[model samples]
Target chain A: MYIADRSGEVIYHPDQQLIYAGLTEESPVADASLSDGIHKEVIDGIPQLVLVKTVGYTGWKLVGVIPVKNLAADIDELQWFGVALLLFTVFLLAFVNTHLSEHISRPLSRLNLAVKAMEAGKENVEFQEEGCEEVQHLAHSIQSMVSTLRHLMDDIIEQEENKRRLEMEVLQSQINPHFLYNTLDSVIWLTENGRYEDATRMVNALGKLFRISLSRGKTVIPLKDELEHVRHYGTIQAIRYKERFEIRITAEPDTEGLYTLKLIVQPILENAIYHGMAAMDEDGEITVHAWRKGGDLYIDVQDNGLGIPGEMLDHLLDESQPLKHSKGSGIGVRNIHRRIQLFFGPEYGLEFFSEPDEGTLVRIHLPALNEEQAAAYQKEGTGYETKA
Target chain B: MKRKHKNLIQLGILAILSLLVILSLFIRDISWPEKAERRVEISVIVRESDSSIWSEARQGMAKAAADYGVELRFLALGESNSVSEQTELIRQEIKNGADGLVVVPAQTEALEVIVKDNPKIPVVTMESSLEGACISVMPDNVWVGEQLAAAIEEDFSEGHVLLVDAAPGSSGIRARLEAAEESLTEKGFTVLRCGADFTVETIEGVDAVIFPEPESAVHALQLLDQNGKTSSLYVAGTEERILAGLEYGVIRGVVAWSGYGVGYQAVEQAASAVLGKELSEPVVESVLVRKEEMYEIENQKILFPIGH
Candidate 1:
């Protein structure tokens, strides 16, 4: 809507001289007054609203204008739709606060690693009592304090294994009277030299080695009756060491029904025949061996002879030292390494590999139990009888 | 905190309903204040200024006075074809303050007493009218002479038709040459009323000449191309020299109108009778063109009167 005239020249505009090329100035509506209303101005920089009037006596005014951002175009489209609904409600509340902190920190981080593995003592502290009820009452009070510290550590380890099985039955009745006084002194020197059939085959191999070292009070046996009691103590030490040492038992047939600790390989085969073949004379050897692996049963023994000296094989199992040439009670390899760590907890025991004269092995270890876990460890007295 | 104060009062009621829908779209885009645009001035009093058909009806009255923002002015009393010099140029355009007149009436019965002595100035008469003119924008001249005598009786059914006749006292070109001489004498075609002469021996044995008048159909196609007359001409009128004599095949058909829609409906009926509105038809249509329907869009808007 325009009409111009006085000296501004644009006789009439009606929308196109480059859309009112800044209303080619009537000095910006020259204080618009021929009388009508609205003035405001600005033009090229936009903000218009003009209106004016007067075309009658042809002084030619008229005006009309408009622009002010087309009157705030609907409040800038409702301020961009309230800033896009406040950024889609802040991205849907950051996706529901990351799914409620991963559903409350994933089971409270698995009950904080089962209470840091029960503060590191770790006796099986399983947790997951599921979450939120105060974290399932703190994982059911740490699984009832790890089941009351594993039933008070299995009642103080079954009263220290009933005082070490009554001190190993008084050290197996003092080793059966020193092995029946060395097998009745080799059967009174072969029945007074008559050599009664080698004194009845050394009294039937010392009556099958004292009926398998007094089996009735069994402390555990079966590796085929512990290799048939070391083959009747190597046939009375090969008729009392006459053949100068060669006891190779080598068991295995699936470790003949497993079980172990009863005079643990006959005190490591009497320390490999009195301290490793008592200073081997000519090719003295002692093998024993036994097998079954991972679930542990291993025996070993080994002994080529005269081996114990890496400074006495570092105190040869140190039962507080006492082994110049221990022939007996020096507590054989620390009492079979404290009865295989008092029954397999110290990861089974005895490792001694020797080397002085190149052979000494003695590996031991234990726990392959079988026969219904050796009759449930001999009715829970931590078991021992397989003397068949 | 009470659901974060009910999410900040529902984001303060969606920011106060988006600022009351942007303050009702800025009060519906600046409410309503701007009205005053009633200028009007219209004076168009032509008989024939420099007649290219009155300069194509003053280019449709200067495009209806630049489309309704009227102030037009055109006065050509056609060099005094004097009816008191076109009644003293409509009394000096109603004393120079014409709120609307649009005349073309050199003598519609002597300008119907100067258009009933300007009954409050809103005149509007074009090719002839004025029993007190307020609307006349003419052109259905007896339906453009009965559609140019039914397009010359579909090309001369019987011969001898030479009807030129419209320049005497122009009673709208003598009522379109008496409706193409009573439709070429009822189609038996022996209607010869000639005035604008075309002589190849006066259109030798005329089978058709009928130039009702676009300047006598360009003076009868320049007297039938200077008398080498190959007769069939039929023009009623749409002058760009009668559409260049129907694009040089020397005019075989045309019964047109729209002298730019009678000068844009005589300045939109003199600006709707000076804004008292209501005049959609005071006679404006007429068609029947033929040099192959002469570029059709309604005969190229009555043969390009300033290209519409």
Candidate 2:
């Protein structure tokens, strides 16, 4: 509030800052000198409700400059207060809902994902125990159930692995007696033909083959020993068939210490002699080659003889089909395929490649294990079979 | 924490804070003690309330009263500037529920004493200050003297100037007389003085006269006119006779201070004091007028307030 005289000189003002600073400009309220009333005027861009009163004889004006908004300041305060209150409530509700959802819904979401993973057959899925007590208890219960289920599954797998080992052992036992019967028959033929030297060599080869096949009651042996067993079996077969087929056995120097399932090659050799070469008019050719590739061992047996028919060859190593017909030692090639899978894992098995009238080749695939690794393999039984 | 408990806590705190805010606003409404419903009544005590000299001043007071939403009562003090009568009026107005006072002090000392005695009643003084007035609306007498002296210098290089002084008890009268004397002396003039003991002999060697008060000017002019003396006069008023004297060459010039400003600012200060508005001492205007410019628009506004 200030007072200005007739000539617009500010004789008195409430604000001394302006007077002391010598601010020489006339106030906008000076215009109030024109009359004595309330008037609306703008000062410095702000609309003011200016009330002017003339000092009676002096023509001085007393101006009360009130901002227009100040007139309704109470109402404005109420409106702002209401708006602020509403915003605060909404914010508070959102905060509570967010925290509640995090406490209850978030853990449930994680639990749902874990259940999905379990349904999808992932056994090593990481489980989290969190959120409210109910959710925590649910998670704990599920984790326990999954733990017990895994243990039961493990027991089933161990039983299946032991059963497979027993089956392979029985198959090996059947192979041995059958091979002995065939060799004894061949020995009798040799002795009756007055081939005493060949009979002695056949008996000696049989002794060495049987000795190596049952080496310290082990199912796995060095490739060289297996090769030696193969050579002795080849000698016996040569004496029995009167050199009807020539068999060449060769192995890479790196495969010397690599071991394989015992008695694996001898049956294949027998099948090559009786089923593969027996029908060939011309002398047959058999090639046995062993080599190491990556961490695995490969043994290929190729026979240049009457190739098995395409339809029959397709089922030769198919374990899903039964080997209703058997030849040589009464052990079908499919049985040997199953024995390799059960003993060394499905990835290590026999693969047959043949075409009609183009000879047959059976590739033996096995993990390349030295002596110490083979012992671990015998102890562990088998890698869990993920046949799919 | 439980959801139910947390909600309760939040609501309780909000309600308490809201109640506190409402309570504070309510307390403010009650504790401040509202002013009375009736308009404030201010008693103005002057020498003579119906004097023509107060026509513009009364109008100024009326306008200020209307602006401040107060009421004014210009009390009649008979035809005299009597301290006893003015003091009796002040006491009566106080008893009659007058919120404040505007005193055209009859005697500065007596009024100051009265003001000190009635400390609760705010008083605004005009033209004089002794003590305890919330505000004093006075004139710049030195400027008035300078203006009058400059007017004389414009007509004459030097002269024997008679300074008519009155109301020795009033500081305003003393200040005006001293200012005029000092200014005229600075102009290398021969200065003479008149007081309550004045006679025609005091005007003997005087080439011109300066009256510092309106009453003194009026009294001196009537005496000069009665005695057929046409000595040039410079008076401190825009009274009718002073204007007439200026027109007819009896008065060379008039140094009239704004009488209206004194009344208006005095009432304003009084109203502000009782109404709880801040105030400060104010100075009213004093203008110089000669016969040549007295009829001009701005000068006419000052000298003749009723028109234009």
Candidate 3:
């Protein structure tokens, strides 16, 4: 405690050295005329809480000076303790929050990721039945639904595949008799013309073509064998037409290893010779070209014969429409289209482009599958499938 | 949801309790007591003010007073070495009901009568001895002087040494110088005495300059620097001067004591006499300091009297 006179002279202080020293010049309390209350002031850059009371009848102020920090010592300690407790509590809550979120969302997030993987064509995904009852039930439901859907889809695909294979066999058998009859008729005519060597060659080509057609009961064969079959068919047709038309078959060396449906090119060749080149007066030309472009093999048959009218050409590949002058079982171009669509999906099929008297070009599009791919396509009904 | 709400309520209650505890702590006042019980008042009188040495001594006295629960009042005789002013301050403290006295007498003989008359009050003299004082707390000056001479002798067996005498009036300083001179002379060395302002020309032929006081050592260092001389210097003084001289290579070694320890011991001795307790010892210990061994623990205690 310190006492200062009315004129601001320091009269008494517990620190005796500060007394008799000029207090009026240094202390803010000396200049303050506070009546009787606590006042905060700065003295020599230190904050002080000064309690000022006027001495009765003396007009001297009795001041009690305490540093502001000293007054808040207890409070400062308590504040530090509170802050430490708060930090510890927040850290604990963070740990609990992490554990809680992991317990609640971990299984759900795993299930979501499994569903996404399924959408990306990953099969037979297994989801864990953990977490809450609702989440476990949802996982169980999804697992059952996926299993059922997979079984149903497999059954439908197998039945459809069997039906398409049966139809292909039937169509393939229908072409055999007509092809043999035409070839034998040519062989007979060659012998009648006294050309015994040509007749022997025609008979040998017919024998080779039939051997490749019945290739161990396999529906798909290498393009090399398919082209050879077409060559034999053209030789017999050339003999029958008697030099009125020419048949030229060419294939790229790279396409020799690739596979195609059996009797595919033979039926198309028959259509071109009978329907396209039969009524031609001058010598007509039939060119068969096979090559590989990207992931597809294209075989185009161009015949410089009397081109079919646009109306008939448009309805040629439509099975629902009957041909005006079709000679076969009325399923010629449409059967090829259906067989290709059933084997390789609708994206790989037949496309025809023609102009009147300018000849017709038939493009047969098929996937360039190797030996292993063709075997997988036949067994598991799976291949390098492309979208339409 | 019910469990979560209950947890939030518990958290809220805990928060409120914490806030209340903090608020209660904030409102509580922390201040010195208005009055202490049966406290004895002791007055300390020193000859000079505004000196770092005296300020450190006052710190020791204040610590003792706090430890012993005694009310202490420190009185200074302005800044001069005035025996009359110090004597008058002691008389004033006695009149003001001082229960005991700790004085560093300006002149030991001049304050004898006043100390003799104050028979009821216990008195302790510091840095100097009085004939009738209850006790005297001071450094062993004779031993310090011998140590200083031995330190210098380590480098020089025989040389003409110049001793710069700064405190000619203090008997304690005089006795230390006499002992140093006697020890150095007995070692087959020549000793010469000079004032603080001794020029480089006066010290040209001297192999070493010995200063028993800090001021004189500082003065000799300045002279050596100004003259660009390479003479070896030694001091028996405070740590500030000795450490600085050693660091700058101006002085080779020091013979010193802990000033703070001396002051602390003085107040302790005074309080012991006041409480009718037997005194342990009157003299404080000194240390021999060298540049190489200055950082050793025992020597460092003397060099840094205070922990800092």
For candidate 3, the docking band is incorrect
lDDT value, residue B300 of candidate 2:
62
Candidate numbers, best lDDT first, in rank order? 2, 3, 1
lDDT of 3 by residue, A139-215 (tens): 99999999978887785677477546655564565466776687778788778889898899899888887788777
Per-residue lDDT over B156-193 for candidate 3, one digit per residue giving the tens place of the 0 to 100 score = 98988887765454556666788789999999889999
Evaluate candidate 1 and give its CAPRI docking class based on DockQ: incorrect
Better of 2 and 3 by lDDT: 2
The candidates' interface RMSDs, in order, read 11.4, 9.8, 14.1
What is the Å distance of residue A29 in model 1 from its true position?
Answer: 10
> What is the per-residue lDDT of model 1 for residues B229-289, given as tens digits with 9 covering 90 to 100?
6667777657666777787766778877666557766887788878888877654666787
- Give the least accurate 10-residue stretch of model 2 chain A, judged by summed lDDT: A15-24
Deviation from native of the Cα of residue A357 in model 1, angstroms: 5.8
Runs in model 1 lying further than 4 Å from the true structure = A1-48, A51-388, B1-45, B48-64, B69-79, B82-101, B110-123, B126-129, B135-268, B271-276, B279-308
lDDT of 3 at A84: 58
Which candidate, 1 or 3, has the higher DockQ?
1
Going through the candidates in order, their DockQ values are 0.02, 0.04, 0.01
lDDT of 2 by residue, B1-308 (tens): 57568667766765665555565445434644364455788998875444666766776687678768888998766745667787788888988989999877777888888788889999887766658888777778677777777777776788898887666656776777788788889989888887745555565447787877676677766777778777777887678878888999888889875565566677888899998888965756668998888887556656765410
TM-score between model 3 and native? 0.38
Chain A only: list TM-scores of all candidates.
0.31, 0.60, 0.58
